[model samples]
Target: MTLMRQETEEIPAAVARLLSSAPETIAPVAAAFRAFDPHVVVTIARGSSDHAAYFLKYAIELVLGLPVASQGPSIASIFGAPMKMGHAAALAVSQSGASADIVAMAKTARAGGALTAALVNTVPSPLADSCAYTLDIAAGEEQAVAATKSYVNSIVAGLSLIAYWANDKPLKTALANLPEQLEKAEALDWSFMLETVSNAQSLYTLGRGPTMAIAAEAALKCKETSVLHAEAYSSAEMLHGPVSLVNRDFPVIAFAARDAAEDSIVEIINGVIPKNPHCYISSDKSADAIQLPFIATGHPLTDALALIVPFYRFVEQLSLHRGLDPDKPAALKKVTVTR
Candidate 1:
């Protein structure tokens, strides 16, 4: 088996380990968040880790009613700009904790008076050392060039911290039951949509709110592992210009969770169904397009994360079918240290 597939299967266990150690690993960060009570939150990350931060963006905004923004690492690493974040908090998500630009930006956020925390797999790396609170994802060694467990664990750790900080009972309960839900998610067969996109050279992935981040992560994995050209856009954003690219044979996948945004996403999928017969969607609601099975985690946040596991399984097989190695994508490394 490819290391990517093996690591993808390890997602549930990795998340459970992080959840089991939450008190020791995440409580202090939650305490810090409560004390800071910042007016704004900034996220620092890149690649798959950036997608985790994007998921947290909706969670923090909707649950905590605080605005969240993503900061480009180049602002500090290249422009050497000064930031006024004295009334804000920063969350840096990194698997390796070794990226020079990410570490530099975290240091900059700290110097500017933001209470900075890092969710990282490596405990004693530079990014962790630079932050005031370092929450280890506890994902262990990830061998594949395409990340699986680390990406899932990063969001799990972030959600755990958010649940504790916001004191949201629903989100906390959903997170507590997430391991079982994730296992069910893994067992789902997303091959229903595979036959549509496996042979296509390019496709479009659609989602809104938190699940848009999942779509973005999925699109990145498709390119890295399978070399398929995929693009992700918000359900609302797609209709503006991107929808023009859709045709009967063009594959479209819509990621809709059991959240308030489900109907809106489904509407987009239904509207496009007549033009594009290859469209597929995931939701409890019935739509004209093909419906993909999804495990509802009882909360919007957890449901969003759960949608990705089955997609991961599908993409791994798709990569193999396309004569590609998901474990060793060309011109990529496990830890990308860029400035």
Candidate 2:
């Protein structure tokens, strides 16, 4: 078995380990967030870790009503620009806490008086040391260069901290049940997409709200594992310009969680079906598009996060189908330290 597949299979257990250690690892950061109560939140990350931060950006905005923005590491590392982060809080997500640019930005945020925190797998690394607070994601050593469990656990860790900070009981309950839901998600067969994706050189992924982040991650996995070209677009934005790219041969996958955006996603999928017959969606509400099975995690936040596990499983097989190595993608390293 490929290391990517093995790490993908270990997602549920990795998340469970993160949740089990939440009180000791994540609660303090939550307490700091509550006390700081910044008007804005800024996220610092890149690649898959940036996708995790994107997921948390929605969660923070939706639940806490605080505006979240992505801070480019280059602003600090490359251009040496100082940021006015005194009234903001910063969260940095990374699997390896060794990225020079990420660590530099974290230090800049801290020096500017932001309540800075890090969600990282490597505990004592530079990024962790640069932050005022650190929550170890506890995803263990991820061997796959494509990054399966570490990405999931980074979002899970951020969600746990958000749950604690907002004192959201319903979200906490949903997170408590997420590991089991992830197991069910991992068992689901997305092979329904294997043939379609394997035949196509490029495709589109669609989602709304929190699931938009999932769509972004899905598109990245397609590029990293199968060497396929994929772009993610919000369902709300699909009809504007990107929909013109759709044709009979083009494949589309829309990820819709059991949230307010489901109906809108279904409508968008139905609209695309006439232009392209090879459209598939995760929700059962769609009329003509093929429906992919999804495990509903009983909360909108977690429901969005759960969709990635099955996609991870599918993309691993898709890489093997294309006679590519998912574990060792071309021109990529396990830990990317960019400055």
Best by lDDT: 2
Query: How do the residues 179-242 of candidate 2 rate in per-residue lDDT, one tens digit apiece?
Result: 9999999999999788888999789999999999999999999999899999999999999999
> Any runs in candidate 1 off by more than 4 Å, and if so which?
none
196-245: candidate 1 lDDT, tens digit per residue: 78878789999999999999999999999989999999999988999998
Every candidate's lDDT:
0.91, 0.93
Q: CA shift at 243, candidate 1, in angstroms?
A: 0.5
Model 2 clash pairs are none
Candidate 2's C-alpha runs over 4 A off are: none
Q: What TM-score does structure 2 among the candidates reach? A: 0.99
> Per-prediction RMSD in angstroms?
0.9, 0.7
